[model samples]
Target: MRGFTVIWLGQLVSMLGTGMTNFALSFYIFEQTGQASALTIAIFCFVAPSIILSPLAGALVDRWNRKVVIIMTDLAAGIVTLVWLTIVLTNGNLEMWQIYLGNIITGAFNAMQFPAFSAAVSLMIPKEQFARAAGMLDFAGAASNILAPAFAGALLGTFGLVPIMLVDVITFLFAILAVLVVHMPQPAAEMIPEGNKRPSLREDSLFGFKYIRERPSLLGLQFVFTALNFISAFGAIIATPMILARTGNSAASLATVQSIAAFGGVAGGLIMSTWGGPKRKVQGVLLGMSAENLLGPIVIGLAKAVPGWAAGSFMSQLFIPIINGSNQAIWQSKVPPAIQGRVFATRRMIAQISFPVAVLIAGPLADKVFEPAMSSDGWAAAIFGPIVGTGAGAGMSLMILLSGIVGVVIGLVGYSIPALRDVEDIMPDFDALTAPIVNNEPAIQSQGE
Candidate 1:
């Protein structure tokens, strides 16, 4: 508990630093290039490499000592930040290409850190506390979301990017120090699934996919997330535009809506931390998703004012942490600690696959198809125009409303599926496998005497 607590606090601080750097770098690139494309490319560089490398990273996480992996990732991330600071100082400015490269390098290392950290948490904390731990993690993310943009914006105006990067480096040092001081527990002998037969790296890497393929319940759970991410992408892609259009393009209005929504997330995380979620994690997940799916879009779609949108958005955002916290708890309890690295990585890869595709299609869907149809004199204008209004963001609002309905349908359909609804029952808890670790000694050992 102490080890997990120390590591969690360190990582929370690290996340804030990372968030500041992310905002500052994106701000710098956007300001320099004066082009949204350059900013998007910078973001893609950060994300794509991590997605591409996750399977291999997960495999390596399983093969190596997780504590060492955590320590090395912190060191590597710190070195990356330090190098960027050096470049900015030496050159007097960072080029767009250099920023892209730095993001890719740091992102690749981060791909390894997340799975290793999650797997380690399962070993460090009691099984009953998994939801509470997940809630705390979500709280950090929400807090970072609330603070980072404002912090970076203020600092950038006063001090600029170098100081922000320096702050990030210091936070990484704290992270490294935290891991160094704590002894991470390992899987007991009985918990190792594959006996002593070591395979090639490629085989090990693909094992996560194969493992999930055999488990219908886990696969069903992932499918639910796939649908949710895909549908949610519509709202994410158009949230700002819709707000701006509806509010006569007021940036302050959009900011206000965002701040309120972020506050909702913080509140939700706090609630989950206190409640520890439902006994049936799946039930909690379903309830949260149902509320989000039903309330988020409907309220925002119908709103003509910022307060309506903000209220709707707040209600919607409130469920996210509960949904995620409960879902994380289910995974932590159901999956064996030794193999969580590979399994959770596969989960990440699969769940995220649909969102990018959705993002790519959302713009065209809103502009060419939806916006035109909902024009003042167009076909859908006659039918839905009166409800959602006509022109500008009307079609996008309609799209949001439809997307919410789709999410609700997905949640209902997912719950109707026996394997998914009964996932907790179908997948037995793995806590017993981890109960015998006498201390935090390394549990890398052969099976069956």
Candidate 2:
């Protein structure tokens, strides 16, 4: 716990720095282009490469030292930030291409960093404390979200983007230093039977998919989250545009709404860390999703003012920590530490695969389809105009509304599935496996039966 605590603190600072930079960059881009497509494209560049390469990176993380993986990836990301700073200092201007390139490079590194950090945490913490530990991690992210926008907003007005980038580079250095001083345990080497060869890298990479496919409960949970991610991306991607459009492109209003929404995440994380979650962790996940969808986008779509948007945003983020923390605890307990990196990576890739696709389409959907339809004289005006009103952001609002409704349905449908509902009970904890470390693979009964 002590080692985990130190790492958590350092990562917290790093996240804050990164968040500040992201906020500043997003604002700058949006203010310049005033286009949702540009922002979505930038986000796509950052996410697509990571999702595509997660399996290979996961395999490498399992084979390499976890601490080293974390250190190197963090260092790489820091160097990328430094390069951007240098370009900004020298050139006195940044092009969209530079931002896209940097995002691509750092995204590749994150594919390795995430799984390694998750696997390392599993080794460091006790099984019973998994949920609490996950809560703390979420808390770190939530705290960053809460602080970044406010700090970035003030600094961007006073000092500019250079200072924010410098802070990000410094925080990355602090994170690397923290990792340098900590001791991380490695998974024991697998023992091969006489005349039997070890698994190849391809086999190792594919193992995570194979393992999940054989477990009905785990597979069910993955499908639910995959759908959730896909549906949620539509609304999430368009949120900034919706707010800006409604507020006549007011940056202060956008910042206020974002900060308030992040406060909800911070509060949720604090509660989860202290009280843990429901006894049935799946309940926490499903119920949280339902509550969030009902309270968040639905309300936002109905509102035309900053207060309403802020309220909706707050509710939208409040349950995120509970959903994520509970879900993470389940995975950490069910999967043995030895293969967690690959399994978690595969899990992440599958769960988030829809996100990039949704992001890619969200901009077009909002800008082309929905917005025009919801216009005063557009086709959709007769049907949805009375509810959401006919205007510039009305079509995007309709899309957000539909997304929330579908998200609620997804949660409700997940609850109806017995496998996902009883995943914790259906699958034994890693410690309870008969041969938990057989050939560096978990030896558990396949729930496919």
Candidate 3:
């Protein structure tokens, strides 16, 4: 736990620095290009590589030293930031292509960083503390979300992007130093028998999907998240536009709603960290999701003012940490530490694949279908106009409301499935199966073992 705490603190600092840089870069691109598409493309460059490379990266994480993976990836990302800083200083300007390329490179490194860090945590902390550790991680994210933009906005207006990139690079160095000081445990199973051949990369990469497929409970859990991410995407993409359109493009209103909502996540993370979530982890995942949808999107969809939007946003963000922490704990407990990198990476890939798809379609659904239908004299006006009102953001609000309804139904349906509901009872904990030695030391037996 001490080792993990040190690493966690370092990573938290790194996240803050990285978040600031991201904020600065986003503003830079938008300011320079004056095109939303430019910003969107930059984001796509950053996110797409990670998703595409996750499986291979996870396989590599399992095969290599996890600590080394973390250090190297952080170092590489830092180098990328350093290069960006150098370029900015030398040329006094950055091209869009350069930014996109940097994002792609950093995103690729992140593919390895996340799985390595996640797998390392499972080894460093006691099994029972997984949820708490996850909560702490979420807390770091929430804190970064709240602080980064504010800091970046101030710095960008004064010192500019160079200072932000320098800070990011320094944070990476600090993170690497933290790892250097810690004694990271390695699973004995990762060490192959003397004469056995190592598995092929293809086999290793595919292993996670195969492992999840063989476990009905794990597969069911993945399905639930996939559906949830898809539904959640609708609100995520449209929330800003809906708020702005309804408020006549009031940035102040949007900021107020977002800042308050981010606070909810911070509060939720704190509570989860202290409480360590529910005894029934599945309920923590399912019921939390249900509550999140009911309280968040549904309320936001029905609301007509900033207060209502803020309230809905806050409630929605509040449950995110609980749901994520519980789900992560379940995966950590169920999967063997040796294979967790691949399994967890695959889990992430599966769970997140829906969001981009939904993002792409959500706009058209709002512009072409829902908004038109809900227009003052549009076809849906007769039916839904009275409830959601007619005009600009109304159709998007209806889409959000529908997404929430479906999200709630998905959570409820997940609980009704015996495999998913009784997942904890049905699947034995990995520690109970075999007492694997760590760091080449003697195996420490679990109580069940």
Candidate 4:
């Protein structure tokens, strides 16, 4: 727990820096070009490499020293930051391609970092504490989401990009130092599942999918989350535009509503950390997500005012941490420590595959399909318009409403799957298999702080 705590604190600092830098860069690009497509390209570069390369990265994490992986990734990321800073300092300008390339490099580093850090977590923390640990991890993300924009906005206005980049570099140094000092327990020889044999890198890279396929419970959970991710992405893709259009493009109102909503995620993490989720973790995840999916779209779709949208958004965001924390705890408790890197990576890759697709289509869907349909003279305007109302962003609202219905159906279907719902009962806990070396204190000395 102590080692995990140290790493968590370090990662949170790094995340805050990363978040601020990302916000500042995105703002810079948008301000310079005034092109929405530029922002899209930047985001694509940020996420695409990680998704495409996660399988290989996961295989490496499982094979390599976990602490080394964490340290090296941070080092690589820091180096990229240094290069960016150098370009700014020397060249006095940065091309879009260079920024895109840097984002790709950082994304690749993150692909490896996530699996390594998550696998390391299961080793350092007790099985019963996985939920609380997951809460703390999520709190990092929620806190960054809330704090980074505020912090970056102020710093970018006062000190400019140079100071923000320097701060990011410092944060990376802090993260690397923490990893260097802490000892991460490695998987023991005996911890490998019985009869499992080492294979080539290619075969091992695909092993996560194969391993999940062998277990109905694991497979079912994966499918459920894949659906959840796909559904959630649609709403996320249009959340800002929806608010802006509905609120008559008042940027302050949009920011206020979003910030208020984001606090829900932080609040949810705090609650989960205290409660440690429900006895039936899967049930808790499904029910919480179901409420989030069903209620949010309805309120937002029918919202005639910003307050309505804000309240709905707040409730929707609130359930995210609960779902994520409960889901992570289940995976941590069920999967073998040795193979967790591969398994968790595969889980992330599949769940996130929908996001890029969603982002790509969201604008077109709203502009060509939904928006016109809900136009004053369009066919859908007569039907759904009377209900959700008509005009700008109404089609997006309709999409949200439809997406919510689909999400609810998916949750109900997941709940009905006995294998998934009863996963804890059917799958044996991996703690028994990995108990011997789960906590290796020799690898990490307690630095009397």
Candidate 5:
């Protein structure tokens, strides 16, 4: 417990530093290029690699000492951060491709870090504390969300991105030190004769998919997320930027708006920490998704349509992650421990495949189809006039509206699917929330040999 506590604290600091660096980097790109396209590319690079390299990373995580994996990732990440800063300082100008490369490399290393950490947590923490611990972990991110933007703004106004990058490097070093101090006791099963063991990598990576294949319900649940991410793309990436451009807010103000949204996430995290989740984790997930999905576009679109961009963004930020965390809690408990590295990674790969694609198409889609129609005196005002509005942000608002409707429809249809609905009943006993309802029997107790 002491070891875990120490590691968690250090990682919290690292998370904050990571958040600050991201904030600084996004604004730096904006300041240099004055184009939203560059910023979108940076975001794309950061996320796309996880989908690309996850299978290999997952395989390796199951085969390695998990603690060593965490430490190595921290050390490598720190070195990369330091080198990037040094290069920027040595050179008078930074190129767009250089930043793009940095982001892609960062994403690649991050791909290794997450699976190892998650699988390690599953090994280290007892089931009773799993949801509670997850809540606190999310809270750390929420806190970072609240502060990182402001911290980056301060650093930018004072010394700049290079200094903030240094701070990130230092935080990584500190986090690595924490990992060094903690001893991750090996799982008892790992001590058994090597020949009798499952093929660690192959078995781990394929297990989650196999589980989903057999259950169908869990697969359906995850499939719903895939649908949601693609549908929401129209609003999240496209409409918000257009709205801000129309309103004449600077890059800094937009960052501030995002920070306000983090405040919402913090509140939601705190609430989940105490409540755990609803009696039925799946029902809570569905309910939360339904509620937040509608609110997101409304908040995002109406802000552009009216004068409430800040307020709208804030509300969406607050609720969306809470729903997401609830979904994560469900998966964490439901999936078996040995296969989590591969299974969860595979699930992540599938769910996020659409994100980069959606991001790629979002801007263009807005420019070619949605934006033109919603412009003043465009077909939007002439035809679909009432719901779309008649102002600067009309097109963007309409897009948000459309995405929201799609998220809701997908969620409802997902709820109706018996396979997804009954995954709670059919899958092995995991969480009490869905366990008894599914099996009509007692729960499985963990009895290590």
Candidate 6:
């Protein structure tokens, strides 16, 4: 099979496996002990390790053989998941730290897999097709997300997490096999000198950062969305749950909403596959932001008041693949193959920082401010009394509106920023993809820092 074809298949299978693991694990931990903090710790364990190691992972990816990196990570992940599956099968005693440890290790492996995959994409796919490929990848992920919860429930109730984990293990094994079968050429001579003693893995990883330094625009482009990511986290996770609680939405309804949202991703991906995204893919990003700005928060806010939550989640989700697909195309076209792994890895690392912080603040805000503000005759009643309104879950509604306002303002700011809003004009190179060398070998150093 062609490298891209193999990769696309691997991604689809792996995403489904991952989605199942996520659903099963979250449900398992929550059902075991309803403490919110347990879940929080689990999340922190999973995410924090990855965050801490991203810089190192990117650098290593640039220096290492991309295919080898991918295979190794998959192999390790499969082994680890297998072990976890056995623990689940035995119905042995489980501990919080054990779950955390498992989460942290898996997350680290996942982080390593990203750079390798992104860099590989740069080597394998037609530049113009980047968006379409991304759309497909996004769609697969979204579809998997939709199926995971229901699948997890079935597996858990019948055979439990062990059986589900066995499936995950098999998925990882297949993913590794896919990578093993593909051929990936190496970096350019220009990027890695002909005879200079090969640098240590750490030094190679840092090359990604250096590459970014050479191109300031790429660095800046990554930064433009930092604020948006930070704020969106709060609205996406915290706000929805709080508002839903206020509404008559049941647990199953919330899960249904979550599952339905994936269809939007499917639509976006299918559309991009056919449309190949906009002429200037950056416009897709901007458009996505604009849509998220206006639609997402409004849906979350009114979910309680209107029946929109019944369908809004799906509607909003539809935009995700559209935006994600466009972003992938833009990156693929601009970044050189050699450096793509490191650069994309570094990019992901920086972008993800907002999530933890956002979650931290979000938990408190929903608990303290948003929830109480609109409560019957609460704080807002005394001040913005007329603004929020009387009764009828005004606070949650107000929070949603404010979230939308924040998203819109952020989009406007992005529009104003010359480098970000007008990235296509400045980085016009994305419009053109020239085959630079024989064998489609990687030509750029990976980005890491």
> What is the C-alpha lDDT profile of model 6 across 70-169, one tens digit per residue?
8888887777778777775676645767788887887787788877777777767677777877777887788777887567766776776777787788
- lDDT winner, 2 or 5: 2
| Model 5 C-alpha lDDT per residue in residues 233-317, reported as the tens digit of each score | 7777764355555656364676667677777777776777777766666765676666776676666665543336656666666
Q: Please provide the root mean square deviation of candidate 5 (C-alpha atoms, Å).
A: 4.7
lDDT of 6 at 428: 44
Preferred candidate (TM-score higher): 2 or 5: 2
Q: Would you estimate the TM-scores of all the predictions? A: 0.83, 0.95, 0.86, 0.86, 0.86, 0.84
Q: What lDDT score goes with residue 301 in model 5?
A: 64
Scored by lDDT, the top model is 2
Give the residue spans of candidate 1 off by over 4 A.
24-42, 75-99, 156-163, 189-196, 240-255, 301-306, 363-399, 432-449
Best by TM-score: 2
Tell me how far the alpha carbon of residue 3 in candidate 2 is from the true structure, in angstroms, after superposition.
Answer: 0.9
RMSD of each: 4.7, 3.5, 4.7, 5.5, 4.7, 4.7
The Cα error of candidate 6 at residue 420, in Å, is: 1.8
- Residue pairs with clashing backbones, model 4: none
- lDDT for model 3, on a 0 to 1 scale? 0.83
What would the per-residue lDDT of candidate 4 be over residues 1-449, giving only the tens digit for each residue? Answer: 88887888898899888877876786677556643346556677767778778889889888888999989999998899889989988887678999999989988888998899899988887889989988887777777667776777778766767877888899999989888888889875423333344466897799788878888898888788788777766666666566656666554565566566767777887888888888899987777778888777666767766787878877877787788889899899988887788888888887777766665666667767887898788889888987788887788788777777788888888998899889989988876643432223112221211
Number of colliding residue pairs in each model: 0, 0, 0, 0, 4, 12
Off by over 4 Å in 6: 32-37, 91-93, 157-159, 190-203, 239-251, 305-307, 372-378, 381-401, 428-449
Q: How far in Å is the alpha carbon of 182 misplaced in model 4?
A: 1.9
98: Cα error in model 5, Å = 1.1
Score residue 298 of candidate 1 by CA lDDT: 75
Which runs in model 4 stand beyond 4 Å of their true positions?
25-41, 81-99, 156-162, 190-197, 244-251, 304-306, 372-379, 386-392, 433-449
173-235 in candidate 1: lDDT tens per residue? 988888999999876533333334545688768877887888899888887898888888787
Clashing pairs in 5: 217-419, 217-420, 264-318, 425-438
